[model samples]
Target: MSLPRNLCHGTLDEIVERGGLTEVTGADGGPYLELVSSAFPGGQAPVGEARVFTGDSIAKVVYVGLAVPQIGLDSHMVFAFCPADVAVPHFTLDSVQGQGTYAFHLDLIPRADLGTHLPYLDWAHTPLDATYEEVESRPGLMKTAIGPRQFAMMSPWMLVHRAEDEAFRGISDAVKAYLDHWFSLVEAGVPAEVVADVADTDLAARDARNRTNVFSPDVDKVWAQVERLIGHEQTEAVRGLLLDNCPPEVSA
Candidate 1:
């Protein structure tokens, strides 16, 4: 009955199956990265599970689900980071349902600077304009304010909003469209002209810096909540897991 949870799980399964992704076991020798806490004031414990995968074209794929039903909070997020060899944008989706509130964030995180790489922008993002506009126009959905710096890190085509239950569920089609487009980009490989002179090391370095900025506490306030729920140590571990990839670290 929870649309966000269902969508996240389904997407995770499909990607792992079709992409030939290999699941990475946690430090506990468990299959998933788990977090549990009883930090809530009313004795409510929040439980979270994070699944990580790796594949040839994708450096890392993370699906995280957290819920504290007593407080009416539930969130699901999926992030697919592209390999350094290609300049394809990373795919991300976030869906949340809370008491009297529903929200989601969908975006393709760019690997190159879109402002300067006009061709890359066109090739990776232009096709989503129609779908973005359509989703924006849906009834009972309204923009959820995000910081300017956060916006600068993500693509202009991102769909982030709060919506009614009906409007929230209506996004399944748009999610599918975006996922299909991303998959195609990964499969077809990046056009050489789109990133003509950039070396693989440079691309990897850029991606690392970008991920740091995007997930930093200053840029994403949600980390505070996560830390509270899972403790500071575990929270940082999760962040590191999300940021870490198969690419060798580019030397300074």
Candidate 2:
């Protein structure tokens, strides 16, 4: 896919002067079509890392990429969501084509150690075919032919081709609206019986179990002791109190 027309780059100095990487804003106060990075973490090359081009552009994330700009000698660059670990690539015009489109993948800390280009790699990925093991840090750490993996530790960071509106910012408002409606229904005295639902699923139990999957056996036992100290019924009662504090207007 092609790049956004508004996409533009400034020198490291210019970005530093302008308050670093940020979502572009128009006079009307709109959201970002894409965010920009003027500085990388730990000071790695800001224009040449492959991980920057391969990761997701939205959500809680960190990535690396090869950044290209006009006016300088062409070179392999590194850019990231965090401070750089090395110098960003200064490339010739001939080598700048489609450099921004490359994606970030898992890697290591770069040779440099400060300013905007710190190398950050993904934790690990679950395998296509694996058996899940019950552990403490997670409730189900899957074992693969290659190694141990956890779905909780995995995030697919593929980008959408240009023109995929939802991938950028299309459906966020709609999802929020739908959630508001669900909360409203529950609060409106609409009996879940009329809604044809049985007992609310034990989402907390499931979540607690998942949290244990990554822990060592000793740590898991320790966490269990801590939970017992808190008492299960009291925890549920606290959750109920939280639910009761909901706003009357939205969840009505």
Candidate 3:
């Protein structure tokens, strides 16, 4: 299996094991399964698949993958968001293999603004500093060209880069370290001092806006590529699921 697939499925399994989450049914009142398109306009088979689960501390765990192996485009993404009541950072990963190049973005999306929340920043992200620096300094892991606005939505510790095969394979340890640290935070909960007087409603509102902006096409151009393969409607449908907002298509 490719690294992206392995890491995606593996981390998903771990999340389910710990969270005991149940998949949320679609309007069909059945399991959520989607076949986005049989093939792209160019005749290559394209798959835009999603599975969403929710329960316990996790409000939603969204897994979406798009693949057109004929063109060497395979992107697997996962976002495990905690309920609004808690200030724990959400887990996220986007691993991609495009036209002989390997790239991945990994981070724990912040629920509180790291710049102002010193305790939260130190508790949630500072531990990963060494690992982040190590991976950033790796010889073949060159930084991806991300806009400043998109970077603001994620943490400073996010690992996003294009890598040579060796560097790509070498990232496993760093990925493990990040995941393990996150699992610990989930189990231990954020220090009370970190959340402090922040209201749960405020956290919920900020998270809603953050989720929407993080995936907005204005900040992230990758949605354009997805729209090209899956069409605008299906692309928005997927976005709707990620945002935990309304479905794009629904009856009154």
Candidate 4:
């Protein structure tokens, strides 16, 4: 299998602008953000977008348009919020979903395939939210509020404008598809491959996710679990690499 790849902000920005926004709106009917459209459009080409806060905890979104030279287009980004503590009354953990964002960052995935992302956030994941999906009824670009999440998992608006080449789009699409399918599978209680396909270039990024990405953390702990997992290989010299990079305590 081809080694896992880490995508950059620059590549995604070009393609999305080329693909253009299919639709935009606020999912599940809230005033926090908006969704753009491309899912099932009137035209043969497909597109889609939705924007919301990064999570319920904060109002400001992370920086966007990283792919683009100037910044994102004149639109606010959508964020997949996971609230550790549930909000009160109005949106309950069970009733209305006041806690988590109930979101998934779909990189290389196509707009039409959004349905594929749903399973991971379904009833079983409940307070896990993945609930309250809404979008704009028209055409426009969109973005996600990412907090050191998988580079592919996010759909930053600027990335839409930046990913101009076919290769970049192909890669971006591939990553997005992987994330959607992977996240959905995990939500379904299936085994998840949240491990990173690492390299020297992305060493810092990989470490960042291990540090803050909600889904996964700590290379040694994660690797220990993987080692305990059924019949795995120690390719890429990861064990040695971790020893060289991590603190002695973590390495031990």
Q: Judged by lDDT, which candidate is best?
A: 1
Show how many residue pairs clash in every candidate, following the order shown. 0, 76, 0, 46
Residue 186 error for model 3, in Å? 1.1
Give the per-residue Cα lDDT of candidate 1 at 36: 79
Please give, for residues 1-252, the per-residue lDDT of candidate 2 as tens digits: 112211112222222223233332322344211123233344323332111111112101111122335323122222222111111111100112233332111111111212222221111112201211111123222122212243232222211122222222332232233223322332243343422221232333432342234233233243342223334443233222212112112121
TM-score of each: 0.91, 0.20, 0.89, 0.21
What order do you get sorting by TM-score, best first? 1, 3, 4, 2
C-alpha-based local distance difference test score of model 1: 0.82
Count: clashes, candidate 4: 46
How does each model score on lDDT?
0.82, 0.23, 0.80, 0.24
Ten contiguous residues with the weakest lDDT in model 1:
243-252
Per-residue lDDT of model 3, residues 1-252, tens digit only: 777788777888888778898776666764364646644464534375777787767778888887777678888888888876688888988888899899989999988877677777889899999999888888998899998889999999999999898888788788789989988888887677776834433887898899889989988999998887777887887788888533233332
> lDDT tens digits, residues 1-252, model 4?
111112422223322333232222234443222222222234222111222122222211211110111212121122222122211101100000012111113322111112334432232223322211211111232333434434433222113222213322343343343334333432343323211111112333433343243223242233443233211342112232221122111211
Q: For residues 1-252, write the lDDT of model 1, one tens digit per residue.
A: 478888777777777787898887766656466777768665635488777888888878888888877668889999988885578889999989878699999999888887777878888989898999999888999899887888988999999999898998888899888888988888888777776733323777888899999989989999998887878987886787678575222222
Which pairs clash inside model 1?
none
- Model 4 worst lDDT run, 10 consecutive residues: 88-97
Which RMSD values do the candidates have, in order?
Answer: 4.0, 21.4, 3.0, 21.0
